[model samples]
Target: MENTSTTLTMTRRFDVTAEKVFDAWLNPEMMKKWFFTMEPTNKVTKNDPRVGGSWEIVDHREGKDYRAIGEYIEVDPPSKLVFTFKMPQFSDMEDRISVEIKPVENGCEMTFTQIIVIPHEEGWTEGDIEKAHNEYSSQTEQGWYYMFLGLKQLVETGKVKYPS
Candidate 1:
């Protein structure tokens, strides 16, 4: 069987330097504050932020641990980062994500793109693949929306403000 893939892109402007926004994605200390979970205290982040290096983040929620593991494909400070993302507990599918940061007059803007790929089963039709892509993209977008909120707060104020 082959595989189907879809791309989702999101952009956010920050009132901070490009380097600061870019660093938030790689620095384990900074990542724990805004990367995955609202409860930073319960999150563990370990990163080797370089090309070919690997990173892992585990968020402990409700007595369950959610793990995201990935390998860095490209790391360009103050500019771009590309990585492969996978959650072993959820599925064997691996996704590629690229984050590009550009300096603007006020601060900076980040463009994040994720390519989600899933295996195509024998009985799956075009509609089936499209539906799966839509669902996956929606969930991923929602998750990143919250994460970007936390990232903005942390980078701009040196702290995160959890949503109420």
Candidate 2:
């Protein structure tokens, strides 16, 4: 069976320096404030911000822990980052995410992209693949939208006013 993939890209402008925006993605303390859609009761972030390094974030919400693990494919400070992302509880499939930041007139503009690969099984139709792609794309986009809002608030105001 052949595998299918979908790519989704989102861009947001931040009223902060490029370095600040980029650091928010790799800094453990910054991530704890703006990474998730809902604030986790407890969170642990371990990051090695270099090419070939690994990173993990485990958020404890309610009584369960959700883990996000990945390896750094590329890490260029204040400009670009590329990493693999996976949640063991969700699926075995791993996705690729890339973040690019550029200086604008006032602050910076960030473009984020996620590539999701779907494994195809026997007897799966085109419609089935399309449905899976659409569902994942929509959910991921929405999740990032909220996370970006939180990141913006934290970087611009020194506090996360909008948790979600």
Candidate 3:
């Protein structure tokens, strides 16, 4: 459709090793620990971490069934990764996501970027677009940040703890 458009892109950096950091996303059990916080909240909806991986999280505030079902565009093991994220309910969004890892003395620097494409405005109002975009970016940033932190805590300490 002519109206299909990509509105925003967000990037966040994490302080951790690329290997450890990537594992948090690639590993199913590990991802559940920090990926999506429960509903105000209920149970974990869905969580899978593979090339055709899928995930869904439900809370009183938001209900999202994340579908990252695409062949790995690129996988460089601890160095770089690329995948697709599609959420149909949110105006036909097909997000092209990528992560880059750079090794550092302390650990690794992780940079994540997500490009979200929307088909229609759907129920959004006048200024709602800004709010939606900002909220999405912030929420994703927090999720990734927590993932990195969890990954770091796990590798550095050999234990993983979920947020309460």
Tens-place lDDT digits, model 1, residues 4-45? 888999999999999999989988888888787655544679
Cα RMSD (angstroms) for every candidate in the order listed:
1.4, 1.8, 5.1
Whole-model lDDT values for every prediction:
0.89, 0.86, 0.58
Clashing pairs in 3: 16-108, 39-59
Per-candidate TM-scores read 0.94, 0.92, 0.60
Best by TM-score: 1
Q: Tens digit of lDDT per residue, candidate 2, span 69-112?
A: 89999998899999999998977889999999999999999999
The better candidate by lDDT, 1 or 2, is 1
Question: Given candidate 1, what's the lDDT at residue 164?
Answer: 56
Question: Is candidate 1 or 3 superior in TM-score?
Answer: 1
